[model samples]
Target: MADRFHEGLRSQVAFVTHTRDYRSAEVLPSLARHGFTTTERPHDRETERLLAQFDPDLVVLAIDPRHDDDIALVRQVARACKAQIIVVAPGPHPHGLALALEAGADVCVRDTDGGEMFNAQLGAILRRKTSPIEQEAEDDGPSTITVRDLVLDFDRCQAVRNGESIPLTPTEFKILAYLAKNAGKVVSPVEILRAVQDYTYSEREAQEIVKVYIRRIRRKVELDPAEPSYIVNVRGFGYMLERRSNRRDAVRASEAA
Candidate 1:
């Protein structure tokens, strides 16, 4: 495919993968047409140095989720650069995509996606970086929200409980934040999924996917994962993050029991 040169883009891209030959020919040329300068590195110790030198506007990591260290690599890259990231997982592991996003990638795309689709993802990232609306939203909102003893810092993608930091993946944090933002209301799994992932799914599928992440969040935030007080499941409905008043009532009920 011919590279389409979009003027004024000039974004520098850094691509990192386990091997030098995994779709570089396709990815580099596709990005080039978008007026992005490209650099490639193998996923190794040297990659961080290359990233430091390249100073890219975006970083693309090609990874398989099965490798235990892949998530670590994502964290390493995230710590190494402030660049927006795109993760290309080469197969049908939706869970892997979740983990990649949780680790800090701005977006995750499948290897099977066509060049145009890939470029579109890049364009979206660029737009988000420069969009006036996004800037305005960032400027206008309170960057943190407090829920019970937990404090969520939106600017940092971090959560704290009782003066200690609670470790949460980006997706997990997003789910928790969404729930906190709508505390006391029952939220359907589809609503949680759309709020966190910005994608729609069948209700059943959304339930299963959201269930797993909610369970994971509970383990991190709840005093008892088995009997979650903050994230309460509404039978036949969905889940709710208990409001402070509800939490006190639950506490009183527990004390009486």
Candidate 2:
């Protein structure tokens, strides 16, 4: 049964399992059926070796509670590898999921529904992996906008302000990058909703979600989030990037004068 499922997977995947019985009985056959390559490793050392060797695009971690510090293991693996991870656990716990997220598990699934839900979740993750946002700027060109000492590198998915890197979630980063790319332009909420979520503006409920994400982004990138200097709300319209500078820039300008 597992073998049949494994052969059908459209994307390349790497499976990691520590338990020998589970690996042989369940994991290997399923992975083979889904057309995913399986790499069985004992524990720490071999797991690390295989991860580096395979350099998998996605990692499916089958974790059991009895194993030695599974959470920590997951954390170590996630930190070391750039691949997106989907963790399968015995049961759902809010605290556990929170810990998993901190450890870098992009998605988590409970084993209650058996392997069926696991397979579905795996497929969903793969679908998302296939489509990534196309950057709106040139790779080597100067950024389209600079706001509050921050340089928006749309092509590279990076934001640097005063030599410090500000981490933004994929959605937050995209929203900011898009606004910055079209700087000095008052982009409407409708336009923002379409660009960021790829949803039609007519769905007002979905568009409202954009505001929530924008507020979260502002907290991270703005100096005074209450009076946002980087992402400015244009009253009834939407948002705009404000041009400001760090104190260091001001001091340097004064010295030059």
Q: Which candidate is the best by lDDT?
A: 1
- The per-residue C-alpha lDDT of model 1 at residue 253 equals 44
| Model 2 worst lDDT run, 10 consecutive residues | 248-257
Off by over 4 Å in 2: 1-11, 19-34, 64-68, 131-257
Question: What TM-score fits each model?
Answer: 0.60, 0.50
lDDT of 2: 0.59
1-257: candidate 2 lDDT, tens digit per residue: 33433344545657475532233344455555556766755565677777887887667676753444877777778767777676666554544544554455655555654566566555554433322222232244564457657787654667888889887755567678878877657677678756654434343433344555566687788777775556666655666665544232322232100
Q: Candidate 1, 148: how far from true, in Å?
A: 2.3
Point to the candidate with the largest TM-score: 1
Give the poorly placed runs of model 1, Cα more than 4 Å off.
1-13, 18-26, 29-37, 52-57, 67-72, 75-84, 95-106, 116-144, 151-173, 188-190, 201-228, 232-239, 245-257
State in Å the error of residue 173, model 1.
Answer: 4.8
Alpha carbon deviation, residue 85, candidate 2 (Å)? 0.8
